[model samples]
Target: MSFLGFQLRWNSVLLGALVTAAVLNDVPPSYEALVVLAPVIWADRTTLTWVRIRRR
Candidate 1:
């Protein structure tokens, strides 16, 4: 799979796990921050991918 595909799958799993943890622990800000940051990190990865693809 491509980098983005792997990232997407990983993010999905991470998100689920984090969400479950948050639910079980009453949604702490750290976990909430992680949950929010996942997408931002993914967006950065996506931007990097485009740059790499374009450079090829």
Candidate 2:
């Protein structure tokens, strides 16, 4: 799979896991921050992928 495809799959899994953890743990503030940061990290990965592709 392409980098983006791989990233999407893993990100989905990570998000699911985070959601499950939050639910089980009563949604801690740190988990909330991590949940929010997940997408930002994913976005950064996407930007890096594009930069890599462009460089090649």
Q: Write the per-residue lDDT of candidate 1 for residues 1-56, one digit (tens) a residue.
A: 23443334455556567668888989654966777866755754322242224444
Model 1 local distance difference test score: 0.58
Which window of 10 residues has the lowest lDDT sum in candidate 2? 45-54
Model 1 Cα shift for residue 7 (angstroms): 11
Clashing pairs in 1: none
The TM-scores of all predictions, comma-separated, are 0.40, 0.40
How well does model 2 score by local distance difference test? 0.59
Tens-digit lDDT track for model 2 on 1-56? 23543344455666677668888999654866787866755754422343234443
User: Candidate 2, after superposition: displacement of residue 15 in Å?
Assistant: 0.3
